[model samples]
Target chain A: MAFKTSVQKYTGSINKLEFGSGENSKALGGENVLPFYTFDGNIGGKPLIGLEILDVYPEKWLDELQQIYGDAANNAVQWARFVEEKFSPDFICLRLEGADPNGLNKSPEEAAALAKEVAQAIKVPLVVAGTQNHDKDTKLFEKVAEVLEGCNVILLSAVEDNYKKIGAAGVLAYRHKVAAESSVDINLAKQLNILLNQLGVKNEDIVMNVGCAAVGYGFEYVASTMDRIRLAALGQNDKSLQMPIITPVSFDTWSVKESVASVEDAPEWGSQVERGIAMEVSTAASVIAAGANAVILRHPGSAETVRKLADALINN
Target chain B: MERFMIIGERIHCISPVIRKAFAERDAAPILQRAKEQIDAGAAYLDLNIGPAERDGEEVMMWAVQLLQNEFNNIPLCLDTANKKAIEAGIKVYNRDRGKPIINSADAGPRIDMLDLAAANDAMVIALCAKEGIPRDTEERLTYCTEMLERGMALGIDPNDILFDPLFLVVKGMQEKAPEVMETIRLISEMGLKTNAGLSNVSNGAPKHVRPIIDSVFAAMAIQCGLTAAIVNPCDQRLMETIKTCDMIKGNILYADSYLEL
Candidate 1:
C-alpha cells in the first residue's frame, strides 16, 4: 500500500510553434505534460502573452481602459511601441477592428499598410488578427500576407469557412503561422487543423484558437473544450489536435460587464481595475492549467501578473 | 505527426553480432546495425554494451561516441546492468537530439536506478516486477505503483518513467499474452505510457513467424495504449504495420506520403 502515483504519461505533445523572425522571435507551446506540471514533463516554452491592439480605436471600450493609454491608444504604431517598451509583451496582436464591414469598413489596403507600419515599429512579433468577417479576413489577410512577405508574423486567424484561402496565403506568401479558430468544439478544432494541413500549412504552423471567454461567459464550456482538446492531443495522441493553443483572454474577459462596471455600479465587486485584472488573469490561469500555450491579453498589469504565474509554473 | 517512439533493440549485447563487435571493439558492424534501424525510422537508439564488470565504461563511451558521430548525434538508450556503465554512456550522450534513456529499473532490486535517472535527469524504462515477473495484472500494478511513488518522491517527471508489463513469449504462454495486453489496457487507463520489448513475445520462435507475432502484438499493444517499444525497425513489414496502426489510430497526421515520416 504505497501512495498510488497518479502520474500519467502522454504519447503526444503540444506542438511547438515559432512566430516572427530573428532575435525577437517567440516560440510557444511544445509541452509533453499537462500545463504548469513541470513535475510531469517538459513545459516547453514559457506561456506567452500577446498584447492586443486595434487597427481602429475601439468605440465601445470602457473609459478606464481609454484613460490608461490616452493618446497612444489612437495609433497602432505608437500603441505597439508603447506596449513593447512599457509591458514587454511576447507579441503585439493587431485586431483589424476597423476592417469589420459593420464598423469603419476600412479597405484591405488600409489595414495592410497599418499592419506593416505596426510590425515595423515593434521589436516583438506581430499577430495581425482579422475582423471575424469571413469575406473580409480572406481579403485582408491576403494583402497583409503579401505586404509582410517573409516577415514570419502570426496571421491572426482562419475560421473553418475560410481557412483554405487564408491558410494558403499564410504559407505561400509570408511563411507565417496561421491561427486556426474553432467554435468551442473539439471535433471542429481537430477538423480545422486537418483542413489547414491539407492546404499545405505544416502542422507546426497552425495554432489552435478555440475562442476564449470570461469566467461567467461559458468559461466552463471553453475550458472543457481546451481540456478535451489537450487530452485528445496527448492522452489519445490525436495528431489533428496537436497544434499549440492560443487563448485571447482579454478579447472576451475585458469586454465583460464585470470587468468594466464602475465601483458605484457594483460596490460588492470592488474596484473595476481589480475586478478586470482578476477576471483576465484567472481566466488565463485556468486555461493555462488546461493547456493553453498563449494568452492574448490587453491590460499590461494583468499581463505581468499572469506571466509571473506562468514563469513560476514553468520554472518551479 | 504526434507519433509514439520506437526504440530499436538490435544493438543490444545479447545479439550475437553486437556481442562480437563489442569484443573486438569494431565500430563497423555496430554502425551498420544502427544505420538499418535509423533508416527504418527508429527514434531512439538503444546501446547495450554488456555488463561493464571491467571495461564496460570504456565500451559504453566508445559505442555512444561512435553511434552519435555516425548518426549525427541521435538520442541513445543506455542498457546495462552496470550502473557505472550507464553513467559512462550518459557522460558522452548528446542532449541536442533527445534525452538519454536508462534502459531499466524494476520495483525490486534495481529500484535505486530511479536515483540514477533523477541525478542524471535521464528517462527510464521501469519494469513492473518485484521478485520475478508478476503472476497477475494486480501484482504487476502493485509493482508499478511502488516504482511510480518512489520515482515521484525523488522529483522525477512521471512522463519520463515509462512502464514495461514484461511481455511473455507467446509460444508457451499463449494465454498470458492476452493478459499482457489487459495489463497494458489497465495501465493506459491509469494514464501512464507503456513500453515492451517487441521481440520478447516471439523469442525462440521460427524466424518467419517472429516478425508476424511481433507485428500483431505491436498493433494490439498500441490499441491498449503502449506508446513506446523496442523492436527491430529494419523489419519493413513490421515497421509499416506500426506506422499504419499509428495513422489509423489518429496518432499521426495522415498524408499522401506518410510512410516516409
Candidate 2:
C-alpha cells in the first residue's frame, strides 16, 4: 500500500497576530500544527526574526559587535537605521536596557523619545523592550506606549508584576500589542495570559514570551515549556495559551559565558566572535523548533542564518 | 476537576509476550509491563485476557492477585469476553487506590456485566453500541441511554459507569470521527464520564503516524469532554499530548515536570 500521511485535525490555532503598522507589518502564529509540521496542517505565517537594538549606547558589548555597529551603536535611531538598511531584519527591537535603576538610570521620557526616534527611522515594525525592573519598565513602557501611540508597535513585555499597568496603557489605551513575559514555566505563562485577558486585553493584542535561556544553560526548560504551550494551544484548543510566542534569544545567548568569555580567558573555546554568533544561532534555532512564533536576535549573522532556517523550513 | 485518567492497555492477550506469560502463568513479563505503564503515569491497568473459556476464572484470579500483590494493590480493569472471568478477578481485587472497573457492558449480550458491576460495587465501561459499530451519534446515544438506565436500575452510581463512545478507525470510518466527539459531548452534557479505546482510532495506520493520529484524536476528544481513555501510556508522544491536554483543560495543575508525572 502506498503510504498515505495521516493529517491532524486541530480544533485550536495560534492567534495570527500582526505587529507594527502599514506596508511593513508582519504577522506571526496562525499555525494549527506543531512547529514545522506542515505535513499535518497549516504552518501559517513563517516565524519572524527581529534584530535587537538597545536604546542606550552599548558600552558592555564585545569588540565583534562594536566592529559591526561602529559609531551607530552610540545612538538608538542610527543603530536601528543601520541594522534595518544593512541586515534588513523583519523588525527592529529597541530594548531600553539603560533605563534600569542600577544601570544608566535613563529617564522614561528619554527612553520613550529614543524609542520614537528609532520607530520613525525604521520601515520595518518596531518592538520596544524595557529593563527588568518592574517599576522602571512600567514607567518606561507607559511613556513609550503613549509616545508611540497609534504606531501599533509591540511592547516587549508586560510581566506578572506589572501586567496591569502595562496592559492598560499599551494594549488598552494605545492599542498596542503586549507580550506577556513569564519565566521558563508553562503554568506561569498561561496564568499571565489569563491575567492579561481578565484585564480586558483582547487575545489578538496579546503575545507571549514564555521565557528564554541560552543553549546548554538551562535551555531545555525553555524548549519544553514552549512545546507544552504550543501543544496545549493547538492540541487541547486552549484559548489562554493560543497567543504566538516571541522569545528574546539575543539577550539570553549573548550574556552567557559561552558567548561573552574572552578568548584569552578561555583559550580552548575558539574565537569569541564565532562563539557568540554560534550561541545566538543555536538558541534561535532551538526556540524556533520548540514553537516560538518569532525570535529576537543580536548579531546580523545570527539573524540572517536564523531567517534562512525559518524560510527553508516553513516556506517550502 | 479530576485529572484525566489513563487506563493502561498494555497487558492485553493479543501481544504474544503477554499471551505466553498468561499461558505459562509467568509473572515476570506481565509485572514488567504493568510496572512500566504505572511508572509512565497510567491511573489504571486494563487486564485484557481475551476469552479464557475453560480456565477464564482461574487465569483472571491469578493475574489480578499476581499484579495487585506485586504493585502495591494497583487499581485495575478486568477485560474479557467471559463474565465469570471478570467476577473471578474482582474477587481478589483491592480498592485501596480505586475500585476495579469491569471492561465492559454493552446494550446487547454483555448487558449483564452491569449487574456484575453493581453487585460488586465496581466501575463499568459501558460501550455505546449493541453488536457492531453504531450507525451514527444518535444510535450511539440510544445505546448509551439504554445502558445508563440499566446501570441506574441496577442501583449503580452513574459516575461508576464510564460511557465508551467506541472509537472507530479513521482509515475507513473517517466520517465518523466527528460523531464520536459529538457522542462524548452529549454524554458530557448528561453529566457522565466518558472513555474509549483511543488506539482504535489509529488502527491500520502506519506505525510512524499512529502516534500523531491517536494524539490528535485524543486531544480533540478530550476537548469534547472525554474524561478517560484506555491507551498505551508507553507512547511518549501520546502521553505528552495527554498531559498537555489535561493541563490545558484545568484537570491537572501545570508544573515543569508535568510530563514526568
Candidate 3:
C-alpha cells in the first residue's frame, strides 16, 4: 500500500535494454516505470560501478584519491588489478588520459599496450576510455579496440567529431561495445548514437554517455536532459536513442575544485576526503537517479558507498 | 490517483459490419484490428456492442468470447446501452489481461451498476453527467463525490472508479472547453482519477485540426492530473503528443543516445 496505487499496476511492465555481451556485458537492470521510483515496485541489482584507471600518473589528483591509489595510479595494469581484487568493482574503466594533447600526449601504441594488459588482467568486463580530445580519442580507441578484441569490452567514447573511426573499430574489430558521449546537449547525445549505428554498430552494443558534470555546474540541466531522453526512449519508443547509459562520475568530479582544491581554498567545502567522496557520490547518484545504467568512479570507498545506496534504492 | 490507463477505442460493433462479423463468430476482421491497435500501444479495447436491442446479451457474449479467445485474453471494456449486455459480457470475460471494465455508471439510474461492479471485483467508469452535462466545475465535483461515496459503500477502492469528465466538443462549444478542463482539475484535486473520450473534445472540428486540439487538451489535462483516457490509437499524432508530454512532465527519463524505455 505504500506504493502509489496509480503506479502499482504498471510497475514491472517497463522494459530495460542491457548492453554488451559475454564476460563484460551489463544486465541493464531496474524497474518502476521510471528511475528511482522505489515506492512502486522491486528494484534489484546494484548500480554497476566502474573503477577508473588513469593512463598516466595522476600528478594532479585530489589528495584523497591519490592517497588510496599511490604508486598503482601510474600503472594501468596494476590499477586495474588492484581495483578488481581490492575494490572488487563490477567493472574497470581505463581512461587514456595521457594521450590527450592537453595532457601527457602519449602514443596510441602506449594506449593499446595498456588496454591489452588491462583487458587481459581484468576478470570482469573492461571499459576503455579515450583521452577527451575528440580526434585523438578516436585514434586511441581504435588501437585499444583491437587489443581488447573478443573480450566483450566497451569502448569509452565516440563523439560527434570522430565517431566513425571509433564506432567502426567497435563494430568491425571484436564486435565490442561503444559509448557515445555528447556535450550536455540532448539532441547531440541521440545524434551520436544514430551516427554510431550508421557506422554499423548494433543498438545493443551502444551505451549513452550523457556527459555528467559535478554538482552546481549545470547539474540539473544535465539531469533534466537525461530525463527527457529516457522518456523519449521508453514512452515514445524512439529506437534511435534506446540504449543503456554510462556516466563518467570520477572524471567529472576530478575536474571540480571541490574535489581537488585543498580545504583551505574554500573553508565551507568541508574535509577534502569527505568533500571528494561527496562530490563523486552526489554526481553519480544524480545520474543514477536520472536513470544511469552505469557510472565510473575513482575512489573505492566512494564507489562502495554509491553501490550500497544503489542496491538499497533498486531493491526497495 | 493511479497511473494513466489508455483505453483503446477501436474494435466496436457498429463499424461497418464489423460487429456483424464478430457476432457471427468470424474473427478475421476483429483479430486483425485487435493486433493493429495493440501493436500501436493500446492498453484495452473498448468493446461496444451498441444497442443490439433485440439480442444484446447474445452479441456481448459473442464479442467478448471471440476477442478474448483469439488475443490471449485481452482485457475489454463492455460498452453497451443495455446493462444486461454489459453484465453478460463481464460474466464470461477472462481475467488475465486485467479486470473487466464496465463502460459506465452515473449519478442516476446508472448508479445501480456500481453494486454489480463491486460484486465482481471489476473496475467501472463513472460518467459525471447525471441529469445532463454539468454546467460548471462544481457540478462535476458533486457528481464525482456522489459516485465516490456510492463506490465506497460497495467497498470499492477509489482508484478502481475512473471518472469521465465528459470532454466537450471544441468546434461549436469552444467556450465550454475550458470548463471541462476545470472539471478535470477539480476531480484530480479530490485525489481521484479521471479520463475522457478524447476524440469527443475535437468533434465537429476539421479533420487535421481535431487531433491537434485533442492532443493539446490531453496534455493540459494530464498536467492537471488526468490519469486515464479513451483514445484512438490510429491517431499517430495524438500518441506522439502524449509521449512528448510525458517526457516534458518528467514521467519518463531521457534515454541515452537512444530514448529511455
Candidate 4:
C-alpha cells in the first residue's frame, strides 16, 4: 500500500479576525486543521509575530534588549517606529507597563496619548497591552480605546475580572478587537469567551490569550491548555473557543531565569542575548505548535527566527 | 445529567491475534485486552465475535463466562450476527454491574433484536437506519421513530434503547456530518438516549489522523446531546478529548486530575 495521508474533516474553523484597518490591517485564524497541519487543510495565514514595545522607558530590561532598542527605548512612538522599520513585524504590541498603580502610576490620559502616538507612528496593526492590573487596566484601556477609536487597534485584553467595562467601552462602543485573557485553564478560557460573546462582542472582534508560562516554568500547563482549547474549537465545533489565540510570549519568556540570568549568575549559559533569544524562540515555537495563532515576542532576532519558522511551516 | 458512556471496541474478532485467541479459547489475549480497556476507564467492553455461525452459542457463552469470572462480572455488549449467540451470552451475563447490551438491531429485518432484548431483559443499540444508509435526517428519524415505537411496544425502557445515528465514514461522507449531528439532536430532543460506533467516522482515515477525527466528532456529537458511544478507549487522545468535553459540559466535576478519571 502506497502510504495515503489521512486528511481530517474539520467541521469548525477559527474565526478569521482582522485587527488593524486599511492597508496595514492583518488577520489570523480561519484555519480548519490544527496549527501547521497544512498537509490536512489550509493554515489560513502564517502565525503572526508582533514585536513588543513598552509605553515607558524600560528600566529593568536586560542589556541584550537594551542594545537592540538603544535610544528608541526612551519613547513609545520612537520605539514603535524603530521596531516597525527595523524588523517589519506583523504588528507592534505596546505594553503600558508605565500605567501600573504600583509603578510609575502614569495617568490613563498620558498612557492613552502615548497609545495614540504609537498608533499613528506605526504602519502595521497596533496591539495595546495593559498593565494587567484589573482596576487600572480597565480605566487605561477605556481611555486608549477612545483615543484610538477609528484606528481599529486591538486592546490586548479584556479579562474575566473586568470584561464588562472593557468589553463594552473598548470593544462594543469603540469598534476595536479585544483579546479575551484567561488563566492556564481551558474551562476558564471558554467561560471568559462566553462572557465576552454574551456582552455582544462578535467572534471576529475577539482573540484569546489563554495564558503563557516560559518554557520549563510550568509551561506544560500552557501547552496542554492551548491544545485543549484548539481541539475544542476545531474538533468540537466549540464557538466559544473558536477565536484565534494570541499569546504574549515575550512577557512570560523574558522574565524567566533561562532568559534573564547573567553570565556572573550562570557562566555556562553562554551569551545572555543568545540565551534570551533561545528562550523566546523555544517558547514561541512550543506555543505555536500547541496552537497559538499569533505570538508577541521581545527580541528582534527572536521575532525574525520565529517568523521564519512559521513561514517555512505554513507557507511551504 | 447523563454521563457519556465509552464502550471499549478492542476485543473484536477481526484481528488475527484475537481470531486465533477465540478459536483456541485462549484467555490471555482476550483477558489482556479487557484489562487494558477497563483500566483505561471503559464503561463497558464490546465482545465482537463476527458471524460465529458454526459454534456461535458455545463461543458466546464461554467468552462471556470467562470475562465475567475474571473481571468481576464486567458489563458487556454482545456483538454477533447470530441471534442465538447473543441469546447464549445473555443467559450467562451478570447484570449487577450493568444490564448486558444486545449489540444492535435496525428497523428492517433485524427489528426482532428489540424483541429479543425485551425478552432477555437487556439493553439494545438501535441503529437509526433500515436498508443501508438513510437518505437524510428525515429518513433517519423515521427509522428512529419506527424502532423507538417498536421497542416501546415491547415494554423496553427508552433509556435502555440507545439510538445510534450510524456514524458514516467522513472520507466519503463529509457533507453528511452535520446531518448525523442533527439526527442526534432530534433524537435527543425526543428525550431518548443515543450512542454511536464512533470509530466508523474515521474508518478509512490514516492511522495517525483517526484519533483526531474521532475525538473531534465525539465532542461535536456530545454537544448535540449524544449520551454514549462504542469507541477504542485505549486511544489516549480520544479519551482525553472525551474527558475534557465531559468536564466542559458539566457532566463530570472538574479537578486537577480530571484527565486521570
Candidate DockQ values, in order, are: 0.09, 0.09, 0.14, 0.04
TM-scores of the candidates in the order shown: 0.60, 0.61, 0.71, 0.61
What are the TM values for chain B, all candidates? 0.96, 0.98, 0.92, 0.98
Off by over 4 Å in 4: B1-261
Highest DockQ model number = 3
True contacts kept of 1: 0.11
Candidate 3 structure quality by residue, lDDT tens digits, A99-127: 88987788988878878887777788878
RMSD (Å) per prediction: 8.4, 19.4, 6.2, 19.6
Error at B98, model 1, angstroms: 15
Q: What does the lDDT read for residue A65 in candidate 2?
A: 87
lDDT of 3 at B2: 27
Q: Is the docking of candidate 3 incorrect, acceptable, medium or high quality?
A: incorrect
lDDT of 2 by residue, B98-140 (tens): 8999998899989999999999999999999898889999999
Query: Across residues B56-154, which tens digit of lDDT does each residue of candidate 3 receive?
Result: 998789888988998789888888778888888888999986899888898887887788789888899999879977788778788888999989999
lDDT of model 1 at position A291:
79
Question: What is candidate 1's TM-score against the reference?
Answer: 0.60
Find the 10 residues in a row with the least total lDDT in model 1 chain A: A56-65
Model 1 lDDT at residue A173? 59
Give a tens-digit lDDT track for model 2, residues A1-316. 9999889877679999998898789998898999999899888888899998887777888887888999999888888899988999888888998899998899999889888888888899989888989989999999999999978998988898999999999999999999999999788888888788878999888999999999999988888889988877876667788999999999889888988899999999999989999999999999999999899988899998998888888668
Q: How high is the lDDT of residue B177 in model 1?
A: 90
lDDT of 4 by residue, A1-316 (tens): 8999889976678999998989889998989889899898877788999999998888898876888899999988999899999899999999999999999999999999989999998789999999989999999989999999988888888888899999999888999999999889887787787778778888788999999998999999999899878876777666778899999999998788887788889998888878888999999999999999999999889998998888887667
